[model samples]
Target: MKKKLLVFTGSPRRDSNSAILAVEAARAARKAGASVEVINLSRLRVNPCRACDRCRDRGPGQCVQKDDMKKIYPRLQQAEAIILAHPVYWFTINAQTKLFIDRWYAFGADEYRCFKDKKVGLILTYADQDVFSSGGVNALRAYQDIFSYLGAEISGMVYATSAGPGQVKKNKTALKEAYNLGRELVS
Candidate 1:
């Protein structure tokens, strides 16, 4: 069966650097014979987790709050690979990405082991080139930890340094790497 890849972009800005790389990655994944679905969190109505633990009581994949997340749960469960694209803000992922990830707690509560062995990728954009000074390193580590906790393996990652709009377009190396990362997820 062909692999299914889910690409989630957490940038609120249209045509963001991270989104550009994500689009490239998705295209490459499709070329590599994987069915790809791209989800732009900014266009969705996902809400922050309320920490009610209702998913725990209601069984796996259950959440008390009714919102757009209902549409994402099934996709998350069915994906063979997952790619998270976002910008580093204040040494961590942006609010949208963070909220979407927190909602995964619902899956965790149900002991949803379907994600085990699935491949995961990350595309991060930052203005600062220095890892320590920019906090990009911390964001990368956080993504690694989260994927690990979810029982997924890191397929690859691309960190693109871009300060202004469309800056990533000039970064041919980063773009190629992002595309390769997507291809690797399917391999």
Candidate 2:
């Protein structure tokens, strides 16, 4: 059977640093024999969750929202690995990414179990290169907590720290890390 990866990018602009790395990672995963699907959040019309918990009531792991995510939900269920590619904002994930995560609960209580043992990877871009910055490590930790709650195994976190969108391309160390992270999906 062919393996598959679902990559989600929360960057609001096209070809942002995070999106660039995400595309590269997807390409690497494809070369590694995994089919890839990339979701650009900017193109979606999803909204934040209203804390309705309708998914729990559905008793079958279905999101109540009837928008664009309805289509992606099934893809997410079938993915062997999920990748969150995003840029840092306010020392954490952008509001768009966080909103997506929050709505994930609409699937089902046990629906989250599908993530069990499945691999997850994170690609983060930020303006601060300082590892100790409130935005750097904290963002990773926050995501770790969220993914863990859903039983997803975070295999790796690839972060690009620089001042500009394309600056990551020139950062050999970060690029190597991103490639290695992509390689992990196959291993």
Candidate 3:
């Protein structure tokens, strides 16, 4: 079977810098012979996790709140690699991305074994060059912790700095790195 890659964009703005990078990554993944799916969190109706613990009690991949997240669950399960692309808001991932990730608690709580050994990649765009924008290195560290907890292998990451709308396109280095990261995940 062909490897499946799922790319999730957390940018709420259409054509945002993060989204552009994500598209590039997805394109490269496709070229590398992986089936790729790109999902925009902004277009989804995912809600915050209510901490209901129903999924834990019911079983793995089960959540009480029926929303667009239901659609995400199946794709996530089927993916061999997962890519998260987002712009930094106050030195962290945007609110939309956070909310989407938070809902993954259901899978985490249930100890879903599907996530184990799955490849994970991160594409982050930030306006600041400073590492201490929101406490020192918190965003990357937080994502690292989450991926580790899920038992996913960190395939690669790209941190594109000084990225504003249309700015990331000019950063040839970051774009190349993002594309390479995608290719690496499938390889």
Against the true structure, whose lDDT is highest?
Answer: 1
For model 3, residues 1-119, the per-residue Cα lDDT tens digits are 78999999988885688888888999999998999999999899999999988898877678998899988888888899999998888767788999998988889665868789999
lDDT of 2 by residue, 1-187 (tens): 7788998999997558888788788888888888888899878988777778777877544767678888887888889998898888888888888888877777557757777778998988888757457386887888778877778789988887766667777877877777777778856
Which runs of model 1 end up more than 4 angstroms from their true locations? none
**Judged by TM-score relative to the true structure, which candidate is superior, 2 or 3?**
3
Model 3 bad stretches (over 4 Å) = 130-136
Tell me the lDDT of model 1 at 94: 84
Between candidates 1 and 2, name the one with more favorable lDDT.
Answer: 1
Q: Output the worst ten-in-a-row residue range by lDDT, candidate 2.
A: 57-66
RMSD of candidate 3 to the truth, in angstroms, is 1.6
The C-alpha lDDT values of all candidates are 0.88, 0.80, 0.85
Model 1 lDDT tens row, 18-100: 99999899999999999999999988999888998888888777788789899889888999998999988997788889999
CA shift of 98, model 1, Å: 0.3
